[model samples]
Target: MTEAVEYDVVVLGAGPAGENIVDRTRAAGLSTAVVESELVGGECSYWACIPSKALLRPALARADARRVPGLAEAVAGPLDAEAVFAHRDYWTGHWKDDGQLDWLESIGAHLHRGHGRLHGVRTVAVTGPEGEHELLTARHAVVIATGSRAVIPDLPGIHGARPWTSREATSARHVPPRLLIVGGSVVAAEMATAWQALGSQVTVLVRGPRLLPRMEPFAGELVAEALREAGAVVRTEVTVEAVVRDGSTGPVTVVLEGGEPVEGDELLMATGRSPRTEDIGLDTVGLTPGGWLDVDDSLRVVGHDWLYAVGDVNHRALLTHQGKYQARIAGAAVAARAAGGSAGAGGVDTGRWGAHAATADTAALPQVVFTDPEATAVGLTLAQAERAGLRVRAVDHDLGKVSGAGLYADGYRGRARMVVDEDRQVLVGATFVGPGAAELLHAATVAVAGEVPVPRLWHAVPAFPTMSEIWLRLLETYRG
Candidate 1:
C-alpha cells in the first residue's frame, strides 16, 4: 500500500513560482508541501537566469570599460574563461540545492524529492528514486508549476546528435571554440552575447528577419549591431535542416536550408520552450496533457476550482519574474478560499490592482532583455495599442541626444517610446532601449500601471543629469 500524506496545499514543481506560492500560502497559515524531481531552485537558479547572467556580467563590464577612452586600453585583453566558469559555478551552487533546500525547510514547508503526477482532483502521486511510492492529497489546491523545457526542433539526426539547450549553454564548464545558436528570441540574443564574449566564435541563425521579434524592431536592430561589433556573427532568414554527430567526442555539423553547412564544436538550440505538463497526469483531470494549461484571471484552472496553473505551464508569460507574479496571485487566491471565504471575499479582490488580482498580466506587463543595448518595455506596444483600437499616439525620443546619455557614455545610442491613450490622456505603454536602460523601466512601469494622467505626470519631476531624466524627454515629446 502507498503511504499517504495530506496538506492544505501540495505544490508540484518547486521553481520560483512554486516557491512563491508556498511562501504566500505558508504566510496564510496553510500547511504546504512541495515536490520536485530536479534541483529545488529550478531552472532560473541553476541554468537560465542566474548562471547566464553570471557569465554575461564580465563581458558587459568589459564592454562598458571599453566605451570609456581611458579604460578601453586596460580592458582590451581577453577574459579569463576558466575563472568565469568558476564564478558561474559559484552562482549556481555547483548545481547543488543545499542552500535552497535549507531555505525551504526554514519556511516550514515539507519537501518531497521525486516526480509528482496528478492522480485525481486535488490528488498527487509521488515515486522516489529508491522505489518508494506515496500519495499526496491537498485539501485546498494542487498547483502545476513544473515550468518548461527548451524545444529542440525535429531536425534530421538531432536526437542522436544531442545538441545543447539553454541548460547546457549556461551551465557549460568550457566554452566551445566554435558555437552556433539557433533561434531569434531572448535566448538566442543573450547566448550570442555571452559565448562570443567568453572566447567562442558565436554564430546565430534566425528564421525571422531580425532578433527580438516581439519587441520594437529597433531593439533587435541595435542588439544585432552590438553583437556583430562584439565579434559575433548574426544570420537572419535561415533554418537548420539537420544536425549530425558521429561519435561521443565528435563535433556537431549543422546543415542549413539553402545555405552552406556550418560546423561547430557545439550547437545551442535556443529555439523555444514547451510546457512540461505531459507526464503531470493532466489527462486524469479531463484536460489535455503535453500542452499549455489554461487558467482564469485568478489563476485557477478553468472548470476546476481546486486546480491552478502558474509559470510557463500556463502559456501566460514565459518569463521567470512573470511566473512569480502569477504565483503570488495564485497563492493569495488559495489562501483566501482556505480561510473560510469565497475567492472574491477571501482576499482575491479582483478589482483592477486588487490584492488577489493579477491585473498587470494584461495591461502593465514589463520585460527587460539583458543585452548590451538592453530592451525594456512595459504595457502595450504601439502596434498592440493600435490593434486594440485604442486612440493612441506614440512619442519617440533619442537617448543619444540626451545630455545624461552623452555624459554616461562617450557615444550612447538608445531610443525611447511612450504610447499615450489620447482619449484617456494617460500612458498605455512605454519602451526604452539603450545602455543601462533597464534602470529606467520601473518609472515607466509605475506610469503605465498607475495609469497616471498625462497632465499630472508632468509634475512628477525627474532629477537632472541621470538616465531617468529620459522620462521627462518622453513626456515632453508627447506634449509637443
Candidate 2:
C-alpha cells in the first residue's frame, strides 16, 4: 500500500541547500517535508568540504609554521597521519547523520529516508529502502536541491581500474604511497597538496595548460609552483588515453597519449561535476533527465509556477556557500508565493540584489581555494570584466612588499589584483594569491558587491601593517 503525505513544501535532497530552504520555509509557518537518499547533511558535511579541509589543515599549518623564524626550527617534522585521520573522522562524525537528523526534527520538518522522484506537477513519489512507498503532494512548491556528483571520464579499462572520485579521496582511511590525479580543478590541486604533505608522492595530470583554470592565470602558476616545491609532480597539457589494473589489489596504470604510462596505487579523477537529476523522473514533468535545471533570479523553474531549483542542480554556482545563498532566496520566494503574493510583494524584493533574487551568482561570486598558497577572488577577473564589455583598469601589488605580510612570514610571496570599472569608478573584481589570502577576500567582496566608489574606498581606510594594506597599495598603484 502506498501512503499519501501532504505538505506546503516538498524539498528533495537534504544537503546544505535543502536544509536551509526547509529552515526558511518552516519559519514562515509552511509545513515542509525533506527527502534524502543518503546521509542527512550531504556532500559538504561528510565528504567534500569538511573532510577535505580537515585533511588539508594540518599540512597548511605545518607549512605556515615552517615560514616563521622561531617556529621553523621547532616544527621541522612530518605530521602524524594517524592523528590527522582521526581528526578528520571526528569532524565528519564517523559518517553518522544522527546530529543532522536531530536538527531536522527540531526544525519541525518531516524527513523521508528514500529516493524521491517527480511523479507529476507538485507531486513526488518516494520509495524507502525496504520498498515502502509514499506519495508526497506539495500544496505550494516542490524544490530540487539534489546537488551534483563527480564526473569520471570514459576511458578504456577505467571501470576495472577503480578510480577514486572526490568522495573517496576525502574519506580514504589511508594515504596511498603514490597518488595519480587527473584534472586541474580545485579538487585536483587541493588533493595533490593534501596527499603529498600527508606522505604520498602525488603526480597530477592536467589536460589544460594550468591548474585552477577558471581563476586568474597567476593563481594557477602560484599553486603549481608551491606543489612542485613540496615535491609533487605537476604535469599539464597531457591527455589520458586509458587505465589498466590487473586485479582487485594492484597498481593502476594510466596510459597517456604517445605511449607513455603512469602507474600508481590509486587514480583519482577530479575532472568535473554533473547534476544529479538523471533518475529523478524529470521526464514526467516535461523536462529532460540528467540535465542541469534552469531557474530565474527568484529560483523559480522556467514555465513552472510550482517548481523551483536551488543549489548546484540549478547550475547557478557550484560552491556550497553559493548554494546556501541561493537556498535562502528561493525559500523566501517560495514562502511569498504560498501566501498569495508575488515573489516581490511583502518586501520580498525580487529585483536585482533583492532578498528574493540570487544576484551574487553573477555579480559578485566569491571563491577561495584552500591550497598552501591560498587563492581567493570575488566578482570578476580582469579578463572577465573585459569580456563583459566593461571599461576596466587592473591594479597590481606585491603582497610581500606589505609590512604586515613580511611580519607574518619570513619571506611572504603573494600578489593582489583589483579590477576597477573606469566608467563607474568602482571595483568590479579582486584576486589575492598568498598565504592567508582567504582572510582578505571579504573586504574585496564587499567593495565589488556594494559597488563602492574608489574615492570613498580611500576614506574607508585599512589598518596599518596588515595583509589588508594590500588594498592601500593597489589603490596607490591605481592612482599613479
Candidate 3:
C-alpha cells in the first residue's frame, strides 16, 4: 500500500523558486511539503549559476588584472586550472546537498526525496529511487517550480557525439583542449571565456550574427573583440549541419554548412532551454504535457484555481532571481487565498508593482553576463522600447572616456546606454557593458522600476572615481 500524506501546500521541485516558496509559506504558518528528484538546491546551486560564476570569477579577475598597469605583468602567465576547478567545487559544496538539506530542515518543511507528478487536482504522487510510492494531497495549493533543461537540437549523429549541455560545461572537472561551442548565448560566451582562460583552444560557432543577441549589439561586439584578442576564435553566422565522433571517448568533428569541418575534443551545445514539465503529469490535471505553464501576475495558473507555477516552468522570466521574485508573490497569493481572501480583493495589493504581483519581471528584468567585459542590462533595449510603442530616446556614452573607467583599467573599453521614455522623461531601460559593470545594473534597475524622472535623477549623485560615475556621464550626454 502506498503511504499517504497531507499538507497545506505541496511544492514540486526544490529549486530556488520552490525553496523560497517554502520559506514564505512556512513563515505564514502553512504546513508545507517540498518534493525533489535531485539535490535540494537544484540547478542554479549545483550546476548553472553558482558553479559557472565560481569558474568565471578567477578568469575575469585575471583578465582585469592584466588591464591594470603594474598588475598586468604579475598575471601574464596562465591561470592555475586545478586551483580554479577546486574553487568551483568548493562553491557548489562539492556537489553535495547536505547544507541545503539542513536549511530545509531548519525551515520545518517536509521534504519528499522522489520524482513527484501531479496525480490530480491538489494531489501529487511521488516515486522514490527504490520504487517506493507515496501520495501527497494538498489542502490549499500545489505549486510547480520544476525548472528547465538544456535543449539539444536534433542533428545527425548528435546524440552519439556526446555534446555537453550547460550542466556538463559548468560541472566538468577538466577543461577540453579544443572546445567547440555551438551557440552564442550567455552559456556559450561564458564557457568560452572560462575554458580559453584555462588554456583551451576555444572556438565559438554562432548561428546568429553576434553573441548575446538578446542584449544591445555593442555588447556582443566588444565581447567578441576581447575573445579574439585572447586567442579564441569567435565565428559568427555559422551553422552546424552534423557531428561525428569515433567512439565513446574520442575527439568530435563538427560538419558545418558551406565551411570547413571544425574538430574539437568536446562540443558544448548551448542552444536553448525547455521547461521541465514533460514528466510532471500535467496531463492528469487537464493541462498539456511538456508545455510551459501560463500564469497571471499573482503566479496562479490560469483556469486552475488550486494550481500555481513559478520559476522557468511558467516561462515568465528565466533568470534565477526573477524566479525567486515570482515565488515570493505566489507564496503570498497562496496564503491569502487559503484565508478566504482573494489576492487583490482581500486588502492585498495586486496592482502593478504591488506585493502580490510580479511586475518587475516585465518592467525591470535585470541580467548580467560575466564575460571579460560584463554585459549588464535592466528593462528593455532601444528596439524593445520602440516595439512597445513608447516615445523613447536612447542616450549613449563611451565608458572608456569616463574618468572612473580609465582609473579602473588601462585602455578601458565599453559603452553605456539609457533608454528614456520621452513623455515621462524617466529611464525605461539601461545597459552597461564593461569591467565590473554588473555592479551598475541595480541602480539602473531601481531607476527603471521606480520610474524616477530624469530631472530627479540628476540630483542623485554617483560617487566619483568609481565605475558608477558612468551614470553622471550618461546624464550629461543626454543633456547635451
Candidate 4:
C-alpha cells in the first residue's frame, strides 16, 4: 500500500549532516522527516570515520610508545589484530543503526528507511525496502545529504577480482596476507597504516607523485616516510594496466605499466568519491542527475530557492566535520528563511558566524589526517594563499626544537607552518605534522576561523610545557 507523509523539512539522507539539520530544525519547532537508504548513521559511522579511527588508534598508540624509550620497551610487540577487529566492530555497532535511529526519534523527527528521490520541488517519493512506496512532502525544504561513494577506475578484469572499496577495507574481519592499495588520498594512507599494522604485507600504489596531494607537499612526504618506516611499501607514479582473477574469492593479479604483475589477496580502490546523486531522480526536478550539486553560502541550491544541498553531495568540502558545519548553517538558514529572516519568531541572525552564514567553508576548512605523524591543517596552503593574491608570508618552525616537544618524546619529529597575511597581519593557514600533532589543530582552526591578528595571537599565549607552545614559537618567528 502507498502512504503519504508531510513535514516542514524532508531530509534525503541521515548521515552526520542530515542528522544535524534535523536536530536544528526540530529545535526551531519544525516537523522533520529524515529518509535514509542504508543504515541511519551512514558511511562515517559504519565504514569510514568511526571504524577506521578505531582501527588506527591502537596502531597510533603503539607507534607513539615506540618513540618513547621507557614506553618502547614496555610495548615492543605486535598488535593483536583480532582484538583490534573486535574493538572496531564494537564502535560500528556491528553495522547496526538502532542507536542513531533512536536519537532521531528522540529529537521528534520522522524516520523512513528507503531510497528517497525528488518527485518535484519540496516533494519526495521513496521506495521502501519491501517494494512499498511513500510520498513525502515538505512545506519548507528538501535536503540532499546523500554523501558519496568510492570511485573505482575502469580496468580490464577489475570487476572479476571483486576489489574492495572503503567499506570492505574498513570493516573486514580478517586481514589478507598480501594487500595492494590503489590511490593516494586519506583513505589509502590511513588504511595502509591500519592494515599493515594488523600484519598485512601491504603495498600502496599511488598514481600521483605523492600521497595527500591536496595538502602541503610536506604532509605527504612525512606520511609516506612514516608508512615506509612502519614496514609498508609505498610506490608512487604507477598505473595499473590490467587486472585478472581466476575466481571471485581468489587472488587478484594486477599488471602495472612496464613492470611485473603484482599479486595480492585483495586490492582496495581508494581513488576518490562521486556524489550519490544518480538514482535520486534529479531529472524529475530539471537538475542533472549523477553530478555534484551547486549551492550558495547559505547551502541553498543555486537556482532552486526551496532546495538545499548540504554536505558531500554539494561538493563544498567532503570532510565529515565540514559537512556538519555546513549543516548547522543550512539548518539555521532554513528556519530563518521560513520566518522571513526576522527574529522573535524562531528566526536567526545571518552574520558571519552569527546564525546563518557559512563563511568558514571557504575562509577556513580544517582537516586532521589521523596517520602516524598526524597531519593537521586549516585554511590555505602557502601556494594557495599566494595564488589568491593575498599578501601572505609562511612562517615555519621545527617542532623538534621546541623544549616541550622534546619532553613529549625521546626524539620528537614534527613541523609547523603558519601562513600570515602581511597586510592584515593575521594567520590565514596553519599545518602541523608529528606525533600528537592532532591535539594542536583546534587552535589553528580557531585562529583562521576567527581571523585573529598575529599581534593578538601573541597575546593569546599558549600554555608552556605543552605541544601548544608551538603557537608561541610561530608567533615569535612572525614578530622577528
lDDT (CA) for every model shown? 0.90, 0.94, 0.93, 0.90
Residues 217-316 of candidate 3: C-alpha lDDT, one tens digit per residue: 9999999999999999999999899999979899999999975799999999999999999999899989999999999899988999999999999998
lDDT of 3 at 132: 91
Stretches off by above 4 angstroms in model 3 are 1-3
TM-score of 4: 0.97
Off by over 4 Å in 1: 343-347
Model 1 alpha-carbon miss at residue 254, Å: 2.0
Relative to the unseen true structure, what is the Cα RMSD of model 2? 1.0
Give the lDDT of residue 214 in candidate 3. Answer: 88
lDDT tens per residue, model 2, 310-354 = 999989899999999999999998888888876435666778888
The residue-by-residue lDDT of candidate 4 on 1-480, one tens digit each, is 366687999999999999989999999899999999899988999999999999999999998888887779988888999899999999999999989978987888999889999998899999999988999999999999999999988998888888999999999988899999998999999999999999998899999999999888999999999899888999999998888886868888889999669899999989999999999989988999999999988888889989999899988899999899999999989988887765445556656666677888888899999998899999999999999999999999998788888888878888999999999888889999998999888989999988887878878877778888898888888888
Q: Tell me how far the alpha carbon of residue 466 in candidate 3 is from the true structure, in angstroms, after superposition.
A: 1.3
Q: What is the lDDT of residue 364 in candidate 4?
A: 89
Q: For model 1, what is the error of residue 274's alpha carbon versus the real structure, in angstroms, after optimal superposition?
A: 0.4
